[model samples]
Target chain A: MTTPPETTTASTAPAPVLAPPRGTRLTLRDASIGRQGTPVLEGLALDIAPGEILTVVGPSGCGKSTLLRTLAGLLPPLAGEVDRDGIPITGPDAERALIFQDDALLPWRTLRANVELPLAIKGVGRRERRARAEGWLERVGLDGHGARLPHRVSGGQRQRVQLARALAGEPRAVLMDEPFGALDAQTRAGMQQLLAEVLRGTGATVVFVTHDVDEALFLGDRVALLGTGTGRVPHVLDVPRPRDRTAHDDPATVELRRTVLTSLGT
Target chain B: MTVRHLLRLLSLVAALGLWQLLTAFDVSVWLRFEQFPTVVDVAREFGERVGSEAYWQDLTDSLSRIVTGFVLAAVAGVAAGTAIARSRLAADLLGPVLEVLRPIPAIALVPVAILLFPSNEQGIVFITFTAAFFPVMVSTRHAVRALTPVWEEAVRTMGGGRWRVLGSVVLPGALPGILGGLSVGIGVSWICVISAEMISGEYGVGYRTWQDYTVVDYPGVLVGMVTIGALGWLTSTAVEVLGRRVTRWLPRTESRAEAPAPRRSPSWGRSLAGAADPGPLTSTKEA
Candidate 1:
């Protein structure tokens, strides 16, 4: 509850003292992840390179979210090992940020306050917290609307706030679970482009989970397809470079999309 | 005033007029209306009582007792409820005892209160606290339990510990429900406190009303009933207003129409398109 120190100057610009984000290496070695005692995705072996965007796509109940939870260290793998930079992740850590499909922004908090939550938890100074939150809000194109509560804003804006909030923590890895799935097609496309633009310089590894094939192909450097049936290992595929909306029409991209859709049985 | 406001006022006036007619004409059907005090007689009695020092003393005594009991119950009930909801150990320790005591009417504890407390005032206050506590505790437990798990996950992923999660998420998330319990608690406290005052020796409104009944002062009894009704309405309304103010973040359907435009340019269309979306309004029931 400490008040931010008073500034000597009348300048409004906040000094950006954020440390450069460093990506973490996440490795899942023959991991079996699930809720309770049941295994959802068994014998899952995936190594996510530093600063890589790995989008996971699968049918409903294919353990897409469970895998993301495992990566975030919210839920431990039922068997096998899940590690970050060679160390086994035992619990949730500040180095990893998780974005949920549901509007998880605290409804009671202002958009700026929501974004400032991680920084507060990290014991950041009030002045620095305000500056970083403002910076992230502007980064997500929500500069002047930080004072509004989650319910006051549109669903899409809330998602933007969530993105801002996650990035404000300056986590080494960002785990997103269908973050843009609830938005309209146009808004979702906008979010995808915004997310790509925002992550360009952060150097944070991202694990994006979605059911949409187009979304998976567009946002991911590499796509991992988890089949609907249990005991099926995730089939990893490399997406063609120079991510573009029109790239979906390319022969190689189209073949990959078809292969993914066919594997998913859609 | 609007037609609705006028209609509400008219409804009360009509009821009063019907009561006057029944008593004036001595319409003794299945119910004995002949023995009832007329509206005018009660109004006169109320006027006389309002100017008297004895009436004021009774009013203040009852008010103080209710306020003290209610405040204590609110603090204790919310803390206990949150603990029960959040911790398995607390639930195991306190849950069974509360469940057994919850079903007994607070008014029926008159003899127990008389035996346990040294003074009549303490007994009445104790009864009031007991009446308020269960409703507040039950509502808060449900509220805390009902909060979505995603919020806690979001905070934890941000490296918040257990205490931070409780302060930032659980407490605020369960506030509306706790307030709901408080509102219900206040009403029940009034009912029990008045009954307790009547059963035992007291100088409160309830005691005065019982004394009037013994003396066949029907008009004085009517005045006491009216005063109790008004006091209960006022306190409950105050709690509801406080609840609304504290939980203002909760989406109110009525405010959607007048809400400012969506902050981002792209969401303007989506906002308009989904104007009919009720959002989370259905889950939050205002007092």
Candidate 2:
């Protein structure tokens, strides 16, 4: 296995074309979902690879969020099975952690406690949870603000804490639901940078959901564009060469953007 | 605070003094006949009323009933709000029933309470409870329902469960509205408690007020009304203050107004001007 360089800080290199590793992290087999008893996404089949970052971006109302919810087991598949490491997700299993678009930290709880929530649920003792949660806080650039409530932090900082919360749980994968949509352009960029930096080494497969074209390109290893609400498969985009996209936008990155927009019928 | 506010206040005082003067000097026969007891008569009665154990006991009775009913309503209201928000079936099942009962006045429940409960005291408490219950329930439901789906999904994505998400995300986001409801509910509860006592009881501020009115103790009646007013005013203020305290995590003006806005120099000078900061004169001398 040729591991990508730890520091993706290089100015230029071949774009990383991420593929599903032989070991499947999550498999959506003909999974379908609906609201008000109407089908949204139909018979979807996809394999999210271990240790890879996959993103879902598409036009409005195209079931991008629904797809994330389905994988996280927030919704039951109307048709088929969603298996995780050969085990089916029953309902909101802790093995796969989901991050919300807004920072969902209990306003009463400080940053550290919010990050440590999953551990608390698992009944991990106070000391170990605090140490790990603190480490993840620093990783997300919230080292000194652990005692601060969610309201005390900036939006971008709050999202970083949300990220730390998802990562701190040591789940098999991290699911995100347009976590940066609410942030301003500058903050969104900063959060994107924070995510890429923090999730770099962790082997947790991150399945990020967003409708923003630029964002998916900025952070995703492989991008899947959910078809317009008409129910279409978003042909996955293999991130173009010059693997280190942290610093600049390469040709494939721009083409990939055009492809996603076109796929969403924008 | 403004010219309008000052004008409004001056006009109010002027009107009161004018009315008092008219009553003192004997204006119109009908107006004079219907006039409120003199301020002096009301004051003396108020003092005499306060010194009595009966008045104190009535006040205590009404107050304890309100506190109990309000506490019950708050807890039950929050739980119902959460349940209705989370479970669609629960909302559908219970919503219509609550809606059906909500419009029936709590005072109207007196007869029903008498039939159902062992005593009039419980019935009065029940009336107070009913008055508070609907306000809190409606507020909580709407608060929970009005929440942005993005907020819940946001927490769920961040590794929160059904219970955790409700406790951490839904409740806090719904707090501002919930507090609004509690304030309104508490005020309404006090109003209902006095009214309940008035119609259904032998002892209470309301009953005493009615008793004084029956015998034409107009001064005492005026005193009873004033007592109810003061009690209501104090309790409402306390609820508002307590609600504010519990939700201190909310963005109070204190957070924004006290925020250290960007400045080249310390506004220490401004805060210290007749304020409690260290003395600038002392600092300068030390420097």
What does TM-score give for chain A of every model? 0.91, 0.85
lDDT by residue (B175-195, candidate 1, tens digit) is 989998999999999998788
iRMS values in order, in angstroms?
Answer: 7.2, 13.3
Docking quality band of candidate 2, CAPRI definitions: incorrect
Predicted candidate 2 versus true structure: per-residue lDDT over A1-266, tens digit per residue = 59864533323222343632322278887767765557798877788878788988877788887778878877877777777765676677566777777746566567788788778777789999999998887777666567666765567767878888877777768888888898887667667767787777777888999888777877788888787553455588777534554535566666777777777777
Calculate DockQ per candidate and list them.
0.31, 0.14
Error in Å for residue A203 of model 2: 1.1
| Span of ten consecutive residues with least summed lDDT in model 1 chain B | B278-287
In order, the candidates keep a fraction of the true contacts of 0.47, 0.16
Regions of candidate 2 where Cα sits further than 4 Å from its true position: A1-24, A103-110, A125-131, A147-152, A184-186, A211-218, A229-234, A240-242, A246-266, B1-16, B34-36, B154-161, B252-256, B259-287
lDDT per residue for candidate 1 within A1-266, as digits (tens), equals 48656432324222332543288788999899999989988888999988999999988899988988888888989999898876788999799999999669999888889999999999999999999998988888777666777886777888888998999998999999999889888888878888898998899999999999999999999999999756777889998788698776889888999999988888
Residue B199 displacement (Å), model 2: 2.1
Specify the highest-TM-score model's number: 1
- Runs of candidate 1 exceeding 4 Å displacement: A1-21, A262-266, B1-11, B14-35, B255-287
